[model samples]
Target: MSATSVSSDRVDHLWKGVRAGVPIFVASAPFAVLFGAMAVENGLTVAQAVLMSAAVYGGASQMVGIELFGQHVAPWLIVFSIFAVNFRHVLYSAAIGQHVPHWSPLRKAVAFFFLVDPVFAESERRVENGKRITIIWYAGMALPMYCSWILMTWIGAEFGSQVMPDAHAIGLDFLLSIYFLGLVMGFRKRPRWLPVVLVSAVVSVIAYRTIGSPWHVSIGALAGILLAAALPPRAALPLEAAAVEEATS
Candidate 1:
């Protein structure tokens, strides 16, 4: 392709990515604002609240950190808690890493930096549709959400000083749980899903009763992950069998 056409294609790809990412960013905006409000409510300055949104980026980790900070917990413990909450990103990267083998080390690093939950979902959706994840496109999608998150954080910090009273109390913090549950349900048709979900839920309940709050969360997720990994994938049958299955369906 000519130089002009290449540049045009890059711009086209970027704009397409931005368009695709709009709904995700819009959906996540409330959580971004809430995080900012909580950060300031927990004694962080407005600048600090915005900075945390820009730097940390993980909603769960940021909330856990701010909550721990408010409780006067030790700094190391706070760091550990945040790490525990974000540990799943390691799995996310592992699962998707092979799709971008051609991405350079620096490109991979930059891409991973923007790999939040919604971003991961969109990327995986593209892969399922057999689309390639170009660098410019990834930037276009990620930047809008990333920038809006910081902006919303500032808005929350500036306005939440008085109104931050019952936001958390009214159960806004549970929004993430509902959002994630919906995502998990989206995969209910996948193979062996029932076993994995049942095992995970049972383990999580047991852990919640025994190990307690935060730890139970991770433990239950881990149990499901382990069960999924251990379960053998369904094998493809022969042509005759496949034909019969398709006929029945």
Candidate 2:
């Protein structure tokens, strides 16, 4: 596509992505409620829980933050651990950077603040050519999700203890797994990408044993990148075609 065509398509795609992603944000409600319940279980005050949702705005990081805080890990370690867990966002930023390259540093930083795993995965899939997807689409996904998270967190912190006799047993934590699976099943249509997922899991296990908590995510990211580099597919479409062929054959 011509540069102009690509830019225009990107904007169009961004608009569509925003519209499509709005439902995902709405679908995130139950999970946000679960996060709030988890926050309360972790002994966060309602204010702290809500603020963490607003400030961190990253589900996995907030979960990890609560876990670290509950363990009484040093505050500096908690900060570094959450940062390490979230560092993969740097890669996400790089992927979508072209779409918004001309945006100022302040604007970029603001966009980065709302960057989370789901929005990153969704936006990356929708981007084309070298054009950057507009940050507004990301905001469209993040802002409402953010509000839902904070409000639900406040409610959970206030009332969850009174209601759920065993919140963990109720399986609220599974929402995290389900959310991840949704992202993976969406983008990982290629057989080659399957190996990256496996390698990432293996690396995470190894890192969990050797490096422990926060550093494991860093190792997993490195392993994932290496795996992707090693097993580059011909194209995403070819992978889909291969799957169809296999199923028919």
Q: Using Cα atoms with residue i matched to residue i, what is each candidate's TM-score against the true structure?
A: 0.73, 0.63
Q: Summarize candidate 1's per-residue lDDT along 24-135 as a digit string, tens digits.
A: 8898788788887878878899999898888889887898788777878668878888887677577556655777898998889888988887787677677778888888
User: Which residue pairs collide in model 1, if any?
Assistant: none
Per-residue lDDT of 1-249 in model 2, one digit per residue for the tens? 799998886687556656757765776666666677778787788788888888887776787788777778679978977786676566666655655777789988887776665666555555533434666556665666667767877877777777777656876656567755665565465456678888888999999999887567668867987777777456545432333322222
Using lDDT as the measure, the top candidate is 1
What lDDT score goes with residue 138 in model 1? Answer: 84
Worst 10 residues of 1 by lDDT: 240-249
